[model samples]
Target: MTPLDDGPPHGRGREIWLLAATFLVAAAGMVYELVAATLSSYLLGDSVRQFSLVIGVFLASMGLGAWVTRFVDRAVSGFVWAQIALGVIGGCMAPVMFFAYAWMGEVELPLYLFLVLTGILCGMEIPLIARVLKEVGAAAFRFENVLSVDYVGALAASVAFPLLIVPHLGLMSASLSFGVLNLLVAGISLWLFRAQVSRGLVVVWAVALCALSVFLVQSERMVSVVEASLFEDEVILSQDSPYQHLTLTRFQGRTRFFLDASIQFDSQDEYRYHEMLVQPAMALAPRRQKVLILGGGDGLAAREVFRSADVAAVTLVDLDGAVTGLFRSHADLVALNAGSLNDPRMTVVTGDAWAFAAENRDSYDVIIVDLPDPKSIALSKLYTQEFYAMLAERLSATGVMVVQSGSPLFARQGYWSVVHTLQATRNPFVPGGRLWVLPYHVYVPSFGDWGFTLVAAHPLTPRDIHLPDGLRYATPEVWRAAQVFGPDEADMPADVNRLQSHALVGYYSAGWDAWFK
Candidate 1:
């Protein structure tokens, strides 16, 4: 007959409160992990690698934390202090990383340091809570109960993070808000077990809570200042959509659009890019009545597509509605695209390009793949062999499809991988059961040495295609030179990008790293 049989007078109430604290700390721990992973992905280009490293390092640190808790003789005091430490460290993680990246231009050290510290603190929580629970509990199964509640809280946090937290509160506010929760758990635990915690510890908890509250209140301004430092131009629009962060900046009458801190286009010379992407396919296709544009949410490609009067109906599939909405409604953005998004011939679908291509029965005479670089898994799927096969199914017999491949000079292997993937695609209308691909590149001042791939059933060359009027950069001579890759920019051996392998992402990452890093 020990404490298990005859527990404290209010043992049941104590168990419930301790279990609640366990649930809260677990949720806060998961949120901090997510915030770190997301922030790293935002600052770094390769999301898959960044997320994998963050999660792996965090889980390992947690195991280390749990192992270290055995040295603590006082579980209640240990748990409360760990919570206080986590509250301050985890809460300030994102804002600090943001500022570090903005000012220092390198956050690898800070990112990993915060990750390891918060993960260790999070790891200590469960074992410490279990020990405290056993002191006042009636059964040995209290550990299992605490573990169950911890898992449920993690599930809740994972679900809410992508759906509610990131989109609504953003990374800065979300981290600070969860930090507040961590402090609340600490303060509540201190009050519940007042005899166990000293007065100094209680004062520490109060100060942490008040400081986090101030940060939460001023989180928006803090983010604005930090983000402004990251860019040279004045940030006019900064928003976090479900898929990615969309930012618009203006400098010297030129507007630039960025997604996840990567520049998408500059308004001054966007025509060079858009014209090269859209005009080649439109000119080569035997008929250009129906057109489909994928991933060009800014409407710049659509503006080029509408240049041809033969196009009767155009459907643009873009993942982010915020992007299309801005281009459609905002006076400055609309003027940039010449109101192409609001054109009567345009029908915008705010959904995934792959899903739309898979489900739709309509065939188009021209299809333009104007998506971003394969910096992440999400974008990598667009460059996969399976996705190209799907597009081939929706392509009319005489239709021409063009893909905006990455820079041929900078990302030579990545550019060739797109060509190889398209070449591997089997189309019934083609003679060899393989799509005919003609890889070409153009030099845009904003984005140097970019490439595009034109695919069709039959063999086609730039000489046979007709150039449209009112074009700024692309011309018959420019088209010919674009096809001629210099000896230095010659094709490289690469693997075809498939859904399972996503080999293109690796190629893209390696190429960019060599040049930029």
Candidate 2:
């Protein structure tokens, strides 16, 4: 009865535009979801928790949005409005959240609100498009065609998110870029159906495009503004690696490195941390000829490994090449680690430590796990029974492995969880019988009362410990003293960390939360 119902002169051509727009809208929608989850993980930590919450809220909001569309009388107008809303809201979501996290520190409400708003807008997309096509008498716009293109778009988004978007554009720019895509699609729709779409609506789309354009252009400078609020010192270098956000800050000749806003080490006391992590295991091992360093991409632990005359070769397996590359090339990092990453005897394999340990048939005399804390599921897997078993397989009979357990006082349960999990690897049913684990703690100024666990095939005591020369912080006496714990620091038995449960991440997050509060 309407001109649209009778079909435009170019009905087939319009259908093609609708299908293409459908594909892009679906892709852009998925990008928004991923951006929110990733940003939340970067700021809040516990990646599993952050992603779970974001996905749950986003999907639920999408459902609600779809349900609400049944009441819409104007399909074409609704689609245009939804695209504009999604573009503006989703495009600015990352920058707003980043700024909020750095300054306000209350992101939960705004985060969810944006997620719900964007999800609702995106939820209306496919349904409204389908309705518009039906109104235009385009019978080819079936549910099957719509869903299939949507899925393909989602697949593209998932692939591009890690490989292309986050790596090149960073979160802020990526958000704006996607927003611009949504606006561009909306503009295209407006131009194609100008006779149908209101002039007032065109103005709205135009204004949103201009606003998003300005934000995209200034995204880099805005990142610096956000970084200044989050970090204490002047941020000299920043990078968004595939694994995490890496930032280096300098203050008064001292430098600090942070991964995902959590401090890895400060130049002033990192030697202390590295020495405690590396020396004790090397000292206790019967032979330190072949050493395996897991997750110490900065190469400080390898520097300590090279200090021993016993070490023949060192193999370092760290996940992030960005981190290893930085430590190898940066003048400040090279000086700090004393160019350990460049040493010919040290072989750097930038990949998952789990895979490296599982695949490598060769045995190592000492294995040092100087990995970051199990703040996320991915990192927590490294502390699980499966991973420890893999490490045990590659360890020589007389080899000793050292793990940089989190602060004993701060993350008491988490520290002990690692201890229990490492012991579990030696389960009698499993191939690698049992391991002798000795837990030790040291008071580092930068990180108070840090912990380390030494796992050996045979029992080890203070007398078995050997100290390398030129050690600044740890001596044989200091190592022996570290074995002593106060009543408050007494070991609390915890469940073994496993890939299925990720109990360690919960324990670690809880423990650290209490400490900070």
Candidate 3:
């Protein structure tokens, strides 16, 4: 009878353990990919660059491993033993990779090298499993069936990881759990395929045990090293959210916040920047009763908005729930902002800013664009004409919008392109109105001195400016002078940028390209 029949003493039951081993291997291997991609983005600044390169490197290494599988002795014991080694390495993948760069500083070189090594070793598992699965049946349902099931397992893991695994389990726990799964896989293989194992397999089991142990003890150290390297201070709080690593660290009594690898704020002196961002838009806005705040999860900008008693409703849209939730939960933050997040008038929505804004239109009088600098394409879209048109649609004819435009002197094209974009959106009624460009600079501890450009639909005269009684940063004179730019920062050429087709990105590239080089 065939192995499919349940009546057998050995046919199907024996092969069940082997196939389960195969499934675990596929799951574990894919987890390795996820860990590498996610961790690199967390430790490094650029998400696109980190994810794409690691995927390419891992795939190439897997192919090389598969090719090398041809020459090795195809003993099932030897193959299983090597898988144990891969698990051990991959077990430490997150913690090791997390701390690797901070400890060594050669993150690029050894990171890719370890990735290739893990991929090669991981790739070796399926081919060897297929060979063993072939031992059962030969004529019709044989090696091909086993291979197809392996593919199905891969498909399941790919879906489960981003949706079920990451958001639910987070990094440290997920890595530890997968490490246990891999070890469990090795132990089961040793039991089910006992006749196939060797004396050398003892070392393999020992290594997996060691990795599991290391993952438990030293993972916190990994985070500290990563935090220290990424931020110029001691890390106070760090979390691996489904979306990114949420980190709050301390330097010189000032607390700094980060998402993934990008600095969100240095809380000690953020008031200077937040005050400028919100007050300008609020002052010029025809009515302050209805307001929309985009991407100001820190609530510092929201705190500024809450200052005006005239405001009736404040709608805050930020992507990460963790950020806003922290603002709501932390006693210090809530007290600092006068519990602005929990204020009866405030509404917090967590999700993508682009999608959220698209769904709601013409809903508010004032919109505050308080986002990080446009470092990647995701952020660049917010600066696009399409997004600006949405903002313009939502604006009351008398209503005004202000964006936290990046540094003009640094990304002159980037700064001016924003202005050009605001002008480019063609509507029959509002062909083009008036534009007022106010460029200003502030010192941030993490980013050093930075710049922003404030624009308005109507001519915003100095006579139009006013602030609440409790402001610490801006006075009437300071507000007027804030619009003043120095000789070098002011002398932006005519060719610096054209409307709609923003030269800001190119300008920013030229300015910051040297640091990357």
Best lDDT goes to which candidate?
Answer: 1
Clashes by residue pair, model 2: none
> In candidate 2, what are the lDDT values of residues 339-401, reduced to their tens digit?
999988989998888888778899888989988889989889899998888887788877888
lDDT of 2 at 134: 81
- The sequence of per-residue lDDT tens digits that candidate 3 reaches over residues 53-90 is 99999999888887878776644665666577676677
Candidate 1: tens digits of C-alpha lDDT, residues 392-492: 98999888999999998898999999999999999868556899999999989988999999999778644656777899988877777888999878898
lDDT of each: 0.89, 0.88, 0.70
Worst 10 residues of 1 by lDDT: 1-10
**Top TM-score prediction, candidate number:** 2
Residue 436 displacement (Å), model 3: 5.4
Off by over 4 Å in 1: 1-9, 138-141, 461-464
Model 2 bad stretches (over 4 Å): 1-9, 427-433, 464-466
- Candidate numbers, best lDDT first, in rank order: 1, 2, 3
- In model 1, state the lDDT of residue 315: 97
For candidate 2, give the lDDT of residue 62: 88
Q: How accurate is candidate 1 locally (lDDT)?
A: 0.89
